[model samples]
Target: AEPDPLITETQGFAQSLGDGVDATPYGLPIEYESDVIRRNVEWLTADTISSINFTPIHALDGTITPQGCAFERHHSGAIDMSKDEYRLMVNGLVGTPLVFTYSDLERFPRENHVYFCECAANTGMEWAGAQLNGAQFTHGMIHNMEYSGVPLRTLLEEAGLPDDLDGKWVYVEGHDASSNGRSIPIEKALDDVLVAFKANGEALRKEHGYPVRLVVPGWEGNMWVKWLRRIEITDGPVESREETSKYTDTLADGTSRKWTWVMDAKSVVTSPSPQAPISHGPGPMVITGLAWSGHGAITRVDVSKDGGKTWETARLAKPGEKMALTRFYLDTVWDGSEMLLQSRAMDETGYVQPTKTQLREVRGENSIYHNNCIQTWHVKENGEAENVEVS
Candidate 1:
């Protein structure tokens, strides 16, 4: 079989344009794609205008989201700041208190890594019967991107730590009006936390913390404070409102779970989901989506089309180095009938994501944070999807 020469020539010419004309001084989506925008559930969270913004996961692909499409969740809204005026302060139990301008942060060594930031309250809506009508609300509170930043350890060492600081914790807070705060163990702070300045190879957008943000690899997004301004070493957790009144999980036994930070390994099928229904006909359907964990690398992802009764391992594509987003694909033959699709992830630690029933069995229906249960999406005969609760 011979290839079509004219078609190849046209494709090469298109590539040669090299992302031209449409490229901007500050890049925005093409005007035609304006519809691919952040969407929010008007009454789901808080104020109508100042509430959570969800990513268009249904419209994105290849595991990476352009900075503009990534979701934004702010207690007090995104703060505006100039890079030149930004300052990061290190105080408290350190041997010497110090502050660094944004430029000073650049002077330190830098590294690039890709990771996903997911809100601790991501699946809060599932508390009821598939309240959210679309996948944008069901699975859009997360995004993964490559970040460039100095390791927190670099700045901590530069500030000169106290010899007795071995047991102390670090309280990191944002510069936003709410100052969303959290406590990081000293070991984790020094090990992999990053003071990120750029994401996906460009200066961060204002909504994503223009001057700086924390990249607490593999941790919950709440701990990755945006508009990062202060870091103070303390003897224990700050017990801030975010950790207390919010992020904490409640148990059926009348007690609440606290300090539960690490985001467990999880996966979801993006296509054939509510917002992204199966438009193509039955045969040779491709199922794909993103998977990652704060605990460690994703070791396996299992996909089930006949509900959870039968499971098949998926193939991870271009699974990057450790601690980065891993893309998985499952190719199957569809018979043009209604079906239920679900995915479960197992991390390096041998922990399998529990089913929603199993999760509620342990934590009860009142808790919101850490809902890493297996998710089910029902595909109707016409290919539309609906959020479903599978027993």
Candidate 2:
């Protein structure tokens, strides 16, 4: 073989001195990686203030989503609030109403846990059909991060709840203009919810509710109010507008199912999808994706190349954690043929992610929330892929 000039000759980078460590005091992704960023489809919403942006999941690997590029959804807009001005109020059904400032919260014992917060509408756009063109658009309305905060139980304990706790609920509201209040069952509020102040080892970004936010593990993202302002204990659910009108699941008969909180087990092939199509032709290819469950940890993930006709279990990068994203991969050889790629996730609760056919038959395609149906990507022989639906 002829000598490769690129390797044989001296390269510019190898011959010159590089930048010093202080060039960028606050580190950022190198310019070469500028393409990986949060994206928003203008047609999806009326304005930028009250809209959502998708994470570049196809360009990312592993389970934890980087805070910089994680998705953001806002009812009004991301507010700017300083820790000195933050306050959380606990009232209603408590022996004494108590208010705590940001400093007061820090004084409490804090704990950290990694959890995935997914919008109930993550895959809602595809419920009718293959609407979105990429996995990032269809399933990027989620992000997993290590949250550091005091548990909700700790705050409730300080407020002094009544001895009889049957059929109790808690109403949480944010400080944003829209308030975006949602009611939670007392059982869930006291179980694993947290008053999170930090994410991924850094102070919360302004777009992610800077000073403080509520982390409702295993529940829909809408319930995890950003810029958390108040928590009111009550005898029953508050039936707020967010719960009654927005997030409820509407069925074929026009009846709505309310209080449907937990996000079901779901997975999608990120690479070899519309956005991250294979550039290299055939041979020694790796198919990868992400799987997560709101109910529990993902126990297994199966990949299908022929649109559910056959299945092969994928390898998990690490053991699955409860309510967090799990990275899965399948090492194989591609023969330069067309493929209908799909993935199914099974969680510890024995609940299997359902196919679009199965989901449509039951829900009748009239709803837009809690859509955990399987997704398909049609990959061409030329290495391009597009969103697709199959029987």
Candidate 3:
């Protein structure tokens, strides 16, 4: 039977306003998608005031998440301060201790790069069953955007790092009430770290470290200190509360793991997932989602419609640069029956994402961070999807 072309046209409407009149000083999502919002798991962590918020990954498309909908995870709510009042102090092992006002930071040579930030605890619930029941809850603790900032290497050189300060580490701390701090090896500090101030072409939102934040590309989000204010070159790691009491994952042997900073490659099928089910009938369906890696660019994404029994390489729409999110598409015709959908990402280093079972076998089930396992979504006959565990 022939498909109804008029029905397809009716479902897809034309843009009412032309591009010129549609421009705005501050951009926002289309009105029809207003309900797509950052969500919080009521009982996942602790209190609402200091808890983590999840990004609506299922509700989003493309590689970028608008700054407004970017998930926020803070020990203390965002701190507010004027640009004049903001100062970044550099002390400790430096040859010359110095403090730079926000204006001073702006004067340094700037750089622009896009990177994805994922809370190590993303998909933490899968240690149990398909617990959260939605991609927004299981896989939403992440976001990607192009940031504008001065590289930390530039600032370190500007402060004249001490000639005798060999074997020294550096600690970057935030100004938020919690004052989150993390240490970085000098090698990484000199490589790609940035003191970012802008996300997605505009000033960052209050929740996203407004005036400034630290961006350690290809590293865990815990080290990307928000509301950044100080850079202290030190002789040893600070062993800050964030690293000691939290962020660090506990092992099955009752000991804890430390400095587990790099976020592994991960991928999730956003559509045909809980928040976005198959609403249209069983023909010419586009299965698309996001894939990323903290170690490097995603080299490949394999999609499975039969719960990993068979795999096909999905096409990357706009394969982004290293350390940025990559969009992938898998076009197929659903037979209007039950199906299990999944995706697996392979990073530049040839590291393939592990399954939940594989992850638990190696890292144990006691961890709360860096849970980058394959996700599964079950589609019912009615076209609704639900989270499920295959193994």
Displacement of residue 362 (Cα, Å) in model 1 is 0.8
Q: Report, for every candidate in turn, its global Cα lDDT versus the true structure.
A: 0.85, 0.94, 0.88
Q: Candidate 1 overall Cα lDDT vs. reference?
A: 0.85
Arrange candidates by TM-score, highest first: which order? 2, 3, 1
Rank candidates, lDDT, best first.
Answer: 2, 3, 1
Off by over 4 Å in 3: 1-27, 164-166
Error of 3 at 217 (Å): 0.6
Best by lDDT: 2
Please give the lDDT score at residue 196 for candidate 1: 95
TM-score list, all predictions: 0.92, 0.98, 0.93
Better of 2 and 3 by TM-score: 2
Per-residue accuracy of model 2 over 325-372 as CA lDDT, tens digit each: 999999989999999999999999999999988988899997899999
| Candidate 1 residue pairs that clash | 218-294
Off by over 4 Å in 1: 1-25, 48-50
